[model samples]
Target: MFEQIIAGIEGRIGGPARKVVVDRGVKPDNARHELGRHNPKVVIPLGREGIEMVAAGNPDVPVIAGAILHPSPSTARFHTTVTLNTDPLLLFGRLKSVAPATKRIIVIHDPNKSEGVIRAANDAAGQLGLDLTVIKVRDRRSAAWMYEAVFSSIDGSKDVVWLPTDTTTVDDTVILPLILEQSWKRSFPVISSTPSHMERGVLLALYPDYSKIGNALGSIAIDAVGGGARNGAVFSRQVQAAVNERTARHLGLKLSDDLRRQFDAVFPALAPLSR
Candidate 1:
């Protein structure tokens, strides 16, 4: 999907001739060989670390946009939306600190393949002394109905919407608009695993640094292609928490001074600029 988008943009710019090379996963040594086979002038790998590795090998090869896979290890590994058990616990802790009075937290679990996320959310809620309302969406493929049910369940109730790291929910067509609508109607805030959600309009995001992942990958790619000569290199990973100030303001939520300072990016509300 990203490759297609980049290709379209390149078509307009009359950029270098391009062809895509995809892999099942980002294993540093394996990716280097794959790119070597293609031997394209430029290789743009999705995920921060992948991009960095590629850049490390072929420093001269131009790398454009980078994809952020997982925001953090606790939340979920990037690309795969399945959340680890530790993710929900971290999320619950964050919620407890922010809205200690919160009693019922609504979680939408994908019925098809997210039993783990559901169980983890419930467990996290228990740890935080909160009641968990687990709503399982029967049709995991259709995000519209899943979101509709989530909003319907929380209507006229006091609850925070917890978004699990499920790929079925993260595609551009589904979760993004649902989040925007819920925020507009009820001032409800969303706690999510991906920082991209924060940029899109979610109230807060507690996840890893996606850009860092891309940068890491880029460096590795350069080295594998014999580019990073000056510096000794190794695989790198970094994690951090982030939030969107604009989304918080839109929902009339105030972020703690300490949190605001710690986040990687803070987007303001999009009301004035939308027009």
Candidate 2:
């Protein structure tokens, strides 16, 4: 991803004097050697140690910014069921306003150990003064079991379903179709972390511009390399924000114009439903 972004920057610069050297990651020493093959004027380390070593080895050839690549925080938040519950008070509050009589919301965890989505959802609910029941599933079979269990526990009335951003759940080969099937049959909006999900038919999602993040990092890398700054100064941190719109409309939810205007990007152009 960084490589692609760097390529874009290079295209913009359009000069042979501006050479880019990507350090890749720490474990992949091959990336360093491969970069070396290109004979770049500077080397951009990816991590702390790599940056330090490169700085020490070539004091004159300043190390450019390092790359700190994690799943986009907003994207992470979208997958996070906890954030839905705790942090984004507006989202949960809206849900409450839309479904005033709603007593309990069911959160679905996609059986992935590393997923942070569940935590975000729980947090979002708490922020809205709402209560939720979380269900974890390991596979299609387990998902079915959990779904049934949730239905059984509810009062035979419709309930809101929350889906976390878990790779296992988003995998088209595995969970997406199943989720879409459930959504269509149940008429329940499935909240996810990626806009692609909303585009594909899931009710709603809140995601980040991962490609933009990559591009941002790439631009930073170019600056660091060109400016001859140390890696720590250039690439130690990042700024990220949320992007949601496609998800809201897909699920038939209305976003307030004020809130939509405040966002980095909004999907549908529907009128604001609330202040």
Candidate 3:
């Protein structure tokens, strides 16, 4: 990922002739070696540790990050922070494509963690003419109960459950199995931001396009210092979709070969023929 990011940075800065400093939360002495006399115009970090490392070095230097989790107070340090969470609007739009009859988008999330996501989802629902049913839960216990209630009311023919990137509201070990079980029994579709969920019977997943995300980060970083990029969170528009073909078959979807071709991945990939 960082290699793609470096390639992206080099692309924007007139190719490989220009060097972008790379650091992995190294000690101060090594930091000097990595950053010494570079006087970098921008810094792109990986995680919280990287963010802190770069920010501590020069708070004013523009920092662009990708693949980080929900913003905490600490994230304010970055001039631009791109989250790993897929954009709700984009996700909803894909949901519309895969399940055109879906009328309601159901989600259980922590209000504090998913404020922006819900806000965008509401707009997307309105534009797509789908009902957005959002339930806020403060913790895992409440989230579990809420999931049961919400799953019970789900109209399989017209409702799609959304599993966002929120760990508090969607723990893999506990909540994922419950949702999958409900989905199987009820015959409803489930969509997630996490791609690996497709292997576990999720109908679809929309995840980052690493190259495009890296390029976008480099673009934003360049604009931050030179063209004045906005200082806030934005979702990665460059995305790829994966589908569970078995799940689609279960839902009775008759997607054409062209539509199937569009997907970046398909679950239960065919095994090679023996020689």
Global lDDT of each candidate: 0.55, 0.46, 0.77
If scored against the real structure, what TM-score would every candidate get? 0.54, 0.49, 0.85
Q: Which candidate is the best by lDDT?
A: 3
Q: What lDDT does model 1 reach?
A: 0.55
Relative to the true structure, candidate 2 has a C-alpha RMSD (angstroms) of 9.5
Model 2 bad stretches (over 4 Å): 1-105, 110-112, 128-132, 151-159, 170-175, 215-275
After superposing candidate 3 on the true structure, give the runs of residues whose Cα lies further than 4 Å from its correct spot. 11-37, 269-275
- Higher lDDT: candidate 1 or 2? 1
lDDT of 2 by residue, 114-146 (tens): 244346556767776667777766766676566
Tens-digit per-residue lDDT, 199-264, candidate 3: 888989999877777778878877887858556877677789998888888887766788789789
User: Is 2 or 3 the stronger prediction by TM-score?
Assistant: 3
Each model's backbone clash number: 40, 30, 0
Candidate numbers, best lDDT first, in rank order = 3, 1, 2
